[model samples]
Target chain A: MTAHAPERPAAGGSAPTAPAPGRAPRRRRSGAGGAALTVLTWAIGLAFVSPALWLLLTAFKQENQAATDPPTLLFQPTLDRFSAVLGADFLPYLGNSLTATVASTVLVLLLGLPAAYALSVEPVKRTQDVLFFFISTKMLPVVAVVVPIYVAAAELSVLDNVWTLVVLYTAMNLPIAVWMLRSFFLEVPVAIVEAARVEGAGLPRILWSVMLPIMAPGIAATALICMIFSWNEFFFAVNLTASQAATVPVFLTGFITSEGLFVAQLSAAAVMASLPIVVVGWIAQRQLVRGLSMGAVK
Target chain B: MSAATAPARRTAAEPGGGPAGRRGARAAERADGWRRRAPLLPALVFTLAVTQLPFLATVVYSLRSWNLLRPDSQAWVGLANYAAVLTDSQFLGAALNTIAVTASCVVASMLLGIGLALLLDRRFAGRGVVRTLIITPFLILPVATALLWKHIMLEPVFGLVNFVLSPFGAGDVDWASQYPVLSVVVALVWQWTPFMMLLVLAGLQSQGGDVLEAGQVDGASRWQMFVWITLPHLRRYIELGVLLGSIYVVNTFDTIYMLTQGGPGTASSNLPFYIYQRTFLGFDIGQSAAMGVVVVAGTIIVATLALRLIFRTFMSAQEAK
Candidate 1:
């Protein structure tokens, strides 16, 4: 779980060279302190996680007891809540979310890869300024652009279309994709690129046949983070999409109906909507830490 | 070997010393410079087209008075819309609320995140599981986060919070009703604390073992180690978290929208929600665009300062370890 460092290849050689004789004293000194620290961490960790636990419990309880006064902890488990949320025209919104997320992630990669390559490999004269400009685009709040974009979309007769959302998602994720990919690209040994260059390869050929192959894992990590961000995006999806392109978040928001039965259903829908991303996060824990930090720590 | 037999027209990137014997190489270098920028142009231009053009159009709209509901009533107002937006009571309230939400959420989350990261820095059983559990909130969907808080956790009557506090006879208090802004801020803190935790955790883990051992050998107290050594190394990372967290929290919309819809009469209306209400509900296109321009201006100022700090602190000392 802790091994996301780019110097991972060196660990194999450095492992046995460490001071094995000093390990016993280190372990002895940590005996009591470690026990107390472990218990404290467990307490705080569970406290932090109680919310998700509450959501899961709510998802399984009967509707009448889901939000009962003082709450009901132990109740008969039921699947009816899941059935309820699933019954509501929810699948289409899920599909729309998937389409926009997948398509936009792909588009960001298509455009961002070469840009990252240039920035890292054959940087322009003012590479930092260009990178700053890219980050600047991301810093522009959604409200600023949404106003004019809405007007333009209305003028172009393309409001409320999924394809429009595809475009919005791409713009929203592109700068971040470039920033992250550039950092990942920088971690590749410059010596390898020089070797590739010595083989009489042009820029495109080197990127395609050499850099891409070696950086496949980095690219996968980048793609996963992009997909996660796009999937969880709310502001653009909610504003740009209404009927035909409303994503899972918009669908999940429909549960504000405040009926007795809908509370449990809301929990069920929440669980289903969030399960995939949470699992993805869990599986890619190390890469996620690197991506979240923009590769600063890694 | 390459220099002897290869082409003499190497670019400036070839690093030949003193610009000595390369007449053709200079021209080639200049041309190569422009050529190297080719791969970056498409993405750059595409981003500009999609992002900046709309902002440009917004600037134009802000200068003129336009109403989506009454298209024919449009007329050039110059800076009048900006004047109105600046003077409006709701805008002031929303602006203050946004600052409050952002300041509180960032400060609280960063503190809590640092505490957790420090606690988990040691090797313990089930360390991976504990870290995963703590970081789970950040992975949940935003709208779902709002729902989980609004309905299931903080709803006053039927919430788990009340249930947990029921023994004290204070369980039935309606938190959302009493503290609408704080309610949303707390929920946001819950979601973002993990983000800060993850970043700061990486920073803590990255501390050099040799440096730490030297500190211990020098008979430094744990508190001294933290105050002098640990804190200095973590400043840039903490600042990075603040910058990123502020950017996200400033535009925090979904939670307020779902939880209270900015509630009780602009009590919880941050800038984004206020802007939403203006354009969609009031259809005051000019005023909303004006507010958006103000937001963009504010963001640029903050971003420039943040970038300078991050770059100065981190990149300059890159090889310190």
Candidate 2:
């Protein structure tokens, strides 16, 4: 019964506001407990994050240093690993990743926008059912159809093209993109759209001029998540690509030649491969959280 | 880009004029709709042409007697390929292994996610950084994750895990040879548990503090609160997470491909790896297609169930509200 937090009084229509009750004083008393709770929270958080920190630290050390007798924290730092990783066919892989990721993301947004708009503002019958249909695509395992996909790719001679990935990634990422963007579009306040329509503005015009700017942050977050998913995708990239079209992850596999696994070089490749996404994640961590949480925090 | 290109073409095709063009405008709008839908057509056509065509072809092939080794000697031997796949011990083992590994990974990750989410739910300093760090695993390339576990951490002597254990008289253990399935399961859990945590945490935060506070006011213990309220509230999310997570687990090839290659004696082969080996390595294209068909059919059934369950829960929640 207490679950309902008085819903945001319907947009632009102000409900009579009431003064604060006993909550202001209660917050003052809870401050000390909140601090302790915060510490416990951070401890739990750090414990969870330790694996990633270790992975980063391991990246900086030599292969032998990483596999040391005691797992050495102090190490002879070297840029040679970085240089070696950089000097490989790393750039082309990076290019492939960029092309596939950017293309797929843009494609998803383009197709998804109209679909979402039609589903929302147009009040199409069974829109929710249609929405559910869209989301259901995420349920099937890609590998189930992967063999067929491979055969298809080969037959079409799109074996390693970034465009092949672009298409597949678009489909793979479409479900979630549509799901997320639909919710965002729904939240854009239909009355405003109607107002724009009343003023002779069309749906596309309203979407471009009025709705998109307000929803830019959410849209960016969705695109970034799609980008990450596309970038990290390996099974398809590995199978579909051989030499000319391999992504960074595929190139990273070169470290495991028949001569045996080159642990040092592989680690270097991984570190370099993950750097772009990691940096992006770091800079956009705030936005990532915001988008991922579906604006629950706000 | 193809999808985007569709709309631009539609707009370009339509010329805006005054009231005289109003009737034409509606017709153009209809034209534009179909045109805009066209761009998505190639993508869909490609998906159907590739994935669907091969799928149907596989089904047909499954009934025929065709060996990749002698393509010219292929014959129409109805149901022999199916009988072969059904009777094969490797297929049976693979089916069982696939079920066991997928189940273990899903259940373990869900539990770990719950534990992590519960711990991370409290208001705290540095929570943002920790949150980002925890999700790092999900972001790491799967091949790299597999390689790290297979070569660096799970190596018998020098691997960090073994080195730490060796001091306690835990002698060198070949992960693939000694405990192949468990090794694959662990690697998968490591990669996927982060996903569950992320989803579950999002669910928990969205549930918010009010009902929890009310439960506390009623003198409910943490156990009672979770059992009576929190769990029910999170049921939909857990279902969604489990469903998506299972999809990832079942389809996973890179981990098994890189880590064990389903090897040391086919100990770690799941459906995907089984299909891969049968088709590419063993050159049993017909049987591989059969295996691929089975995997796809199985996945479709499982995914349908998961989706229905999750959707049913969501509907009930809406009704409750």
Clashing pairs in 2: none
Task: Quote the lDDT for A72 in model 2.
Answer: 77
User: DockQ, per-model, please?
Assistant: 0.54, 0.23
TM-score leader: 1
Interface RMSD of 1: 4.3
Cα TM-score per model:
0.92, 0.82
Candidate 1 C-alpha lDDT tens digits along B1-321: 111222233342466555464655676677787777898998999899999999998899999888888989899999999899989999999989999999999999999999998877665678778888998999999899999998888887788888888888874767777889988988999999999988888777666666777888999998998999999998878988998888888989999998888988889999999999998888888889999999989888888897777666445433342
Q: Give lDDT: candidate 2, residue A230.
A: 88
List per-candidate RMSD values in Å: 4.1, 7.5
What's the i-RMS of each model?
Answer: 4.3, 6.6
Q: Fnat of each prediction?
A: 0.68, 0.28
Clashing pairs in 1: none
Which residue runs of candidate 2 sit more than 4 Å off their true CA positions?
A1-51, A126-129, A257-261, A282-298, B1-54, B67-69, B313-321
Q: Whose lDDT is greatest here?
A: 1
